[model samples]
Target: MDEKTGEVLGRVVVTQRVGWCADLVSTMARSLISEHWNTSDVGMLASGEDAEGRALPSNAWMALRRLGWGASAPEGVKVNDRIVRMAQEQAGRTLRSAQWRAELTTGVLTSWPADPAKRTADEWVNVRAAVPGGQHLPSSVIKSRTQQIASFARANGRVPADPFELEGAPGVARMLLLSACDGQQATIECREDDPSRVVLRLQLPVRPDPR
Candidate 1:
């Protein structure tokens, strides 16, 4: 189950319909961890614990627009849904008040369903924000789920390391930019792309060591 990708989940996340379920699950998990959830219906998340036998929350379909969880794509930063879920789950628990950046992100919607009400049926976007009081992402930051990062590193043949101890995307970027070898070197560049956006670039020399 670990090595084989989450097929049903993958289809759900990459598509529109089932994405809200993931968000709800992620949100519920975070709330439990954060001790902020107010509903007694949390048992809905228990394994085989369907109290109402309903697939998910009635408002899940309205998650993005209703909640303003998404914004137009090119106008916003791109992100991965997988990490967004982790961000939600990690939120106030693993992540403290000062852990993430001040700014929050919403999904970058590239396409829309013909029927707005059918939004939950199938949609795609980059993760950027969360529920009213859910986790705020790290600043100038992005976070990746362990599975996503590990799988990519395995295929690429190098595991990154960071001396900065920065968390989320910046941390990953730092690790990737630095070399395991004593003298190996890399270059990183940062610049403002626009009034609201910034760009970060990393250049590393190819190395024989796969660390």
Candidate 2:
């Protein structure tokens, strides 16, 4: 095949699909001709070895180098399909590796979304684990913490103002309060709206160290 014109030359038969052949030809043309070809010239010269008899202008020669000889022209024109295929394959591999690296950095394990929300399965797992009683944390620990909070509220005869009302009890609310408190006084206030629900509010001093 001729890289410039993408025309098969001589009797060298190839079993590859025509599209593959075109890809091969295009690769070779980009590498060998596109960089050097002149854009202004539009004419092609007849294929012959007699430079003096059929010498093309410098600009025409550049275009001709990119175009190769036309389909009806004679033999001896050459194209390296092996090199073309190798270059195309290498380019494909490089692109795939780049995509893989991007996915790895973003924590996308698989291409398909496991949930209807279009999030990956691993992402859903992490989100669930972050929740108070999700599988990511021990169920016993979560239950015990909740029970401690209920007991403390019952004993105080008033719901503790904030999640820290349970004192040392380690629950999601306690974790949040601890993280927000910086060795300063914090207040938790609770208002009972009904038997089933209670509204809780927290107040902390503006200064980092209220002491």
Candidate 3:
């Protein structure tokens, strides 16, 4: 509480449904991707800025590469393939064509090229097929959460991009914390007074923000 204003500050609470730590995995993945892009670009898409100079609409290419994803370029796809394809298909063929190609790449990367409204359980299976892992979370869930955070970044001009930077009551926060967000981290611990009942304790990291 702020003594001067007698107002409460930010607070959050939620149930984990299961002690799966899905949220922790998610936040950490984003942080790793942001950090990877800060110093290096993984050449996942030949159409990206890394070496092949391929244009893409979003930062998802970075995320995919951080996950160690792999894919094969289709036959006949050439240098700057998305951009070239768009220009070849468009009669007017201007700078807007580049935009079209970017959108195309984003769409393909975001979904398994499946319509979102019509996606089913098979999508996760399909993702596992491509991502070199067993099925975990649904592809839609990851995409939607990313979009939610991206929207927050655009509106608030800030988003929590790292969990290692967060600090709170030291061991307490880190031991039980499952999801850390918005300069905050949370953990689930059995209540001391009532060990049978579980409570979520949200905390602000004890460390200073890194600029």
Candidate 4:
């Protein structure tokens, strides 16, 4: 309740159909992420190149298509174009997310802790300083990177030389990231006729935006 305006502030409970949409989106996102969030595909997407050395399209999905690594819907599931757009949208975001991990990996590799199990204060400072935004990165992220390096050393003879050699890419959460967009890429609505079913709208640019 707001005393100043005499207006009550409360939560409005929408139908559970919203929850269904969320689950549906999550399932779809996971499939797309699994298909595209890998080293070979993401590496090509990042480089924007094809096997023949020709430049790829600016659009992530088009770049993927040029490289013959584009994602596809499940077998026998005829999804509409909007769904494909959502997959493209999510793939772009996932590739961008990999960049941070790539930087973090390089920082950790360059300023590796003397002991992978633990880091001294100086080692921690050095690593954080080496990374672009390491100071703001969570300690857990660094720790996970350390653990991966240590594991690699245990299996191989030596520590990894770089992020690419260390690992393909870090795993990211499977999400549609509707909040990140301006409602153009995706939108949600409840169907008055069928309260149990909600409508999720997805619209993507036919061509990549020229920025």
Q: Would you list the C-alpha lDDT of every candidate in the order shown?
A: 0.28, 0.33, 0.34, 0.63
Model 3's alpha-carbon lDDT is 0.34
1-211: candidate 2 lDDT, tens digit per residue: 4444576545323322333434443343334322222211111222322334555423322324334421110134343333233333332222222332222212221221333234466765653454434555553543444455456646887444433223321111111212222223233344555556553322322222222
Model 3 alpha-carbon drift over 4 Å, by segment: 1-111, 132-134, 138-140, 143-211
Provide the clashing-pair count of each candidate structure.
11, 3, 8, 0
Query: Pick by TM-score: which candidate is best?
Result: 4
Between 1 and 3, whose lDDT is larger?
A: 3
* Model 3 residue pairs with clashes: 47-54, 48-54, 167-205, 167-206, 168-206, 176-187, 177-186, 177-187
Residue 196 CA displacement from its true place in model 2, Å: 64
Models ranked on lDDT: 4, 3, 2, 1
Q: List the residue pairs that clash in candidate 2.
A: 161-188, 161-189, 162-188
lDDT of 1 by residue, 74-172 (tens): 223333343233333333222222222211211211122243223332331223333122235432233332233344446666432321112232211
In candidate 3, what residue range of length 10 has the lowest lDDT sum? 165-174
RMSD of 2: 37.1
Give lDDT tens digits, candidate 4, residues 64-103.
Answer: 5566654555454454444455555566667756766777
Which runs of model 2 end up more than 4 angstroms from their true locations? Answer: 1-133, 168-211
**Winner by lDDT between candidate 4 and candidate 3:** 4
Ranking by TM-score: 4, 3, 2, 1
